[model samples]
Target: MKKVYTISEVASLLGKSKETLRRWDKSGKLCALREPMSNYRYYKKEQLSFFEEFNNHQIQDSIDIKPQGDYNVLELFAGAGGLAIGLEQAGLKCAALNEIDHWAAETLRFNRPHWNVLEGDIREISFSGLRGKVDVVTGGFPCQAFSYAGKKLGLQDARGTLFYEFARAVQETSPAICIGENVRGLLNHDGGKTLKGMISILDEIGYRVIDPKVLKAIYYKVPQKRERLILVGVRKDIEIDFEYPQPTKATYTLKDALKKGELFNEDVPLSPGAKYPVSKKKILELVPPGGYWRDLPLDLQKEYMQKSFFLGGGKTGIARRISWDEPSLTLTCSPAQKQTERCHPEETRPFTVREYARIQTFPDNWKFAGPVSSQYKQIGNAVPVNLAKAIGESIVKFLNEKRLIEQSEKSLIAI
Candidate 1:
C-alpha cells in the first residue's frame, strides 16, 4: 500500500547504493522527485516497475509460513547466538551449535543453558555424529579466499579457511539444506573467485548451490542498513526450490529502535556505553543528526580528518550522527572507531551497550557476556535478530514444503 519511498528505502529495495540512484537521477534514468517538506529524494512505486529486480514485493505478513513439523538446525560459527535465537523464534530447534570464541560460546550457553554449545575450534569438532539428525546446516563463515593456481577450488583446497569447516559439517551431516552467510564483499573478494570456488566446493560435496543474494537488513525489519550475502544450497536429492524471503514495505527508524515503538515494548534501558575522547567529542558536537564529517566546519573537517581529508571517497561514516527518522548505517566491531563513528542523534556519544544491542534487534533480556568492549564486538558482529528471523521463516517454509512432498510420495508408495 505504500506509494512512495525515500532514497534510502529505494536503495535497499533495489539493492543499489544511494550514490548510484543520484547518478541515475542526473542522467534522467529513474529520476526522483523531491519531497516538498524535507526536500529529500523520493520515488513513486510505479517508477520502480521498469527495473527487473523490482518483480518481488511480497510483504512480511505473508512470509511467516509455519513449519509442518519440528525442525532442527546445526549452527556453526554461532557468534553470540543471534542467528540461533532467530531460528528458534521461527520454530526451529537448535540441535547443536559450534562456536570457537569462548565468550560467544559462554553467551550462548548462558542464554540457553540447554543448547549444546560445542566450545572449541570447528576444525577439531566433528559433526559426523549429527548426520541425518539436523534438517539444516547454517554458518556465518568469515570470508576467506582460497589460494589457487587457476584450478577449480575444491573442499581440500579450502582446508585452511573456516568455510572449509562449514562445508565439512554439511558433508558430515548431509542436511536437507545448507546456508552460508557472509558480508556482501565476498561476491567480489579476490575478483569473485572466492564465491565461485565456494559454489564449486558445495557442488563437489553433492549439494546444488543457488545463486547468492545480498539481503539488506533494513528490508527485514532491522533498524540498520547492514547487508548480508546469503548463499543457500540444497542436498542433491531435495526436489524443492529454495526461495529467498521477500522484502517488506514497512521500515523502522532509529527512533523506533531506541524508544518504545512497535519494535520494542518499552524504552531502551540505560547501560554502560563507550565514550569519545575530549578531542573527538568536541569535533563531533558540530555534526547534526544524519550527518557525517562533511557537515563539520571547514577548519574542523581538516583537523578531524587530518590526512584522510584529502582522500577521494566520501568517508561518510567519519564523525557520523544517526538521525531519528532514518535507519542507522551498518554497525562495526567498535562503536567509537575513528573510521565508523556511530554517534547518538541527540547526545554526542556512542550508543550505550544496550542501545547497540537494541539497534542490532537484540532483545532486552539477551544479556551479553564479557567486558564492554567485548560486548560491543559481539553485538556489532551479529546478524540483526529480526533479519535472521525473516530468514528463519523462509527456511521453515522450505523445509515444510519438502516435508509435504515426502509425505505425499510415501503415501503413493503405500497405495
Candidate 2:
C-alpha cells in the first residue's frame, strides 16, 4: 500500500503554495480528505493509483487491455509516441516507428529506449522488407488530395501525396489491415470528393475500405470532446469484419484531466511551462469559468476583440476560460493562441506544460523533451493516449477473432 500524505506534502510535491492548494481545493481541482476529529486536509494512499496509469513498472502490460496473443506492428507518422504507447499497452509490439520531426523522434527515443524509431522523411524509407511479418500498419496520414488527373486515380498518380506514401506502405508491407486516422474535416474535404478518391485509391491497392467514422473522444473516457475520423482497410483477400471498441458510460471532465482522479494517480507533476504576458493576463482575469471574452463587459469585449468583434457569430474560443466542472474545449497546438484561446478557469493565463499533457491524457511521469513551445505542439498534435488505448483494445479483439477462425479452418482442412 502507498503512504498517505498531508495536504502540505502533496502541495510540496506539486510545487504550489499552500494558498494556491487551498484555492485548488475550493475550486474542486484537487479533492482532500479531512481527519475525523481535527478536520484537517490530507490525501489518501489510494489517490496515487490514479496519477500513474501503469504500476511502478513503467512498462504498461498488454493484459490490462485484455490483449490477445503476441501481435506486432509498424507505425508511420508516429508523433510523440502517444498512439504507439497506447497500442503497446493494448498488446501490440512496435517493430518500428517512422516520425519526421527530430524533436518528436527524440521524444520517442527518450521515453522508450527499445523502440526502433526511424527519424527522417517517410518517402525515403522502403517498407517492402516488412511485407509478411507485420500484422498491422497504422498512420495518422496527413490529408492531401491525389489529382484526378486521370479521373480514376490509381497508385501511380498518388505518388507525390502523403496518402500516396501511406498507400504505398500498405502495398509494400502487405499487412493484414491498415489503419489511418485523420481530422474529421476529411469527411467533407473538397465536397467529399477527396474521401471518395482515397477510397478509390485503397481499392486500387486491392484492399476493401470500410465506411469511415468520426469517433468522439469524450465517449472513450477522455475529458475533451475532440473528434477524429478513423479510416480502416482490410487486404482484399480477407473476409473478416472489423469491430470498433465500445465506449465507457462515464464522461470525464476537465477537473479529471488536470488533477488526481481515476485518470491519473497523483496531482500533476511540476514541469517548465509558459506564462502569459501581463497584458494578456490582465484581460483574461475578467473572463469567468466556462465563459469567453464575450462574457466580459460590452466595451471590454469590443476592445479585446478589436474590429473582428463586429464581424460574426459566437466565436466561442475567443478569450475563453475553461470551467473546472465541464469538459475542456478542444485544445489547439498553441494553448494560448489568440484566436483559439484556452484560458485557465480561475487564473488569468494559459494552461501550463504539465496541464496541457493532462488534457491530452499523457501520464504525469512521461517527460516531454524540447522547448516549452515545441512540447506544446507535440502534445496538441497527439491523439489522446487513452483514446488510442481504447482503439487498440478493439483492434486486438478483432485480430484474436481472426486468429480463432484461421485455427478452426486449419483443423477442418486436416480432418
Candidate 3:
C-alpha cells in the first residue's frame, strides 16, 4: 500500500503553510482522496514521489486553453504585455490593449503590428464602442481607494483613480467577465478598506465579486517566490461561479533559471545585467548556495552588512545566494539593491535579463526593449507568464459554464 498523508502532515513536513496546500487542492494542482467515513482528505504518497527531493507536489485544475478558439478581449493598463501574452496563448484574441507607458506601448505595437494599441493616459479615452461585445475584460489596475460619500461607495468618487478607469472600461465594455490583478499587499492595503471599496464599486456596477484569493508563484511552476492577488467579477445576471486556476508543480529552480533544466532545456541566454561593486562582490563570494549574510564570515558579514547586522529579524534576503534546489526570492525593481539582494548561486553577480525572464516563465522568443535596467524593471513588474496562463484557463472554465446557462435559458424560451 502507498503511504498515505494528511493535509496538515504534508504541510508540516514541507515547511509550508496549510493554506498553501489547501489552495493547491482547490486549484486541482495536486490530487487527494477523501476518507471514506469521516470525509477527511488524504494524499497517496506514491503520487508525490516525483517531488520527494523538494517535498513539492502540485495539483493543477483542469483549465487548459488552446489556439483554435477566438476569445475577444480588451486589456487595460497592459504593461510590457505579460498578461496579454498569456491570454493570447490561451486562445484569446486581442481586440485592443491600452497602456500609459510610452515604452510598453511601443513594445506592444512592435511585437504585433496589426494590434490596436492605444498609447495614452486612460482618462482621455472612451470605451463606449466595446459595450457588450467582448468576452472578457482584464487589467492589473493599481489599487486605489474610493472615498466613501454615503454608506455605499460611488463611481464619481473613483473618477481620478486608475481602478475607476478599469471599472469604467467594464461599465462600457459590459463583458461577461472581468479580472483585476494586483500585488499581494493590496489585500491588506488601508487595513483592507481599499478592497472593500472596490467590492462595493463592482457591486454597484451590477457585477458580483467572486471570493478573491492570493496565488503564490512558487506553487505555479515558477522558480520565484512571488505572490499576486486576483479579483474576479462576473456579471450579476450570470449564475456561474468563477473558480481560480490550480497551481502546477515547480519544474524549475534558480539553477534552471540561470543554468538549464526542465524549464529552459538550455542555459539562460547571455544578456546585459547589473554588476555588483567590488566590495559587495567580495563579501557575497563567501556565501554558499541558498545561504545569506549568516553564511558569511562573522567579520566580513559585519563589514558588508554594516548596521544591518545589528538589526533584529532574519534579514534573510540580504546578500543571499540563490540555490539550484530552491525557488528564488521575489524579484525587486533593482536586482542589485543592498538590502533586497538577489545573488546568483555560483557567481558573485546578479541575475541577468534572460535569467529574470526565465524566472518569470517568459519564453525566450519574447523580447524586451529599451536599456538594460528598464528591461529588468519590466520583467520584474510583470505577472509570470505561466501564472497568467493558469489564470486564463480558469477564466475560460468559468465563462464556459456561464455560456451554458445562457443556452439553457434560450432553449426554454424557444420551447
Which candidate has the top score in lDDT?
1
User: Looking at model 3, which ten-residue stretch has the lowest summed lDDT?
Assistant: 52-61
Query: Which candidate ranks first by TM-score, i.e. highest?
Result: 1
RMSD to the hidden true structure, all candidates: 2.6, 10.3, 7.5
Candidate 2 lands at a TM-score of 0.83
Candidate 3, 197: how far from true, in Å?
Answer: 0.5
- What is the lDDT of every predicted structure here? 0.88, 0.79, 0.79
Tens digits of lDDT, candidate 1, 292-390: 888888998888889999989776777888888778888988988876899999999999999999999999999999999989999989989998998
lDDT of 3 by residue, 189-211 (tens): 88887888888889989899998
- The sequence of per-residue lDDT tens digits that candidate 2 reaches over residues 291-328 is 77767899988888999899966677778788776667
Ranking by TM-score: 1, 3, 2
**lDDT score of model 1?**
0.88
Per-residue error for 261 in candidate 3, Å, reads 3.5
Model 1 / residue 406 / CA error / Å: 1.2
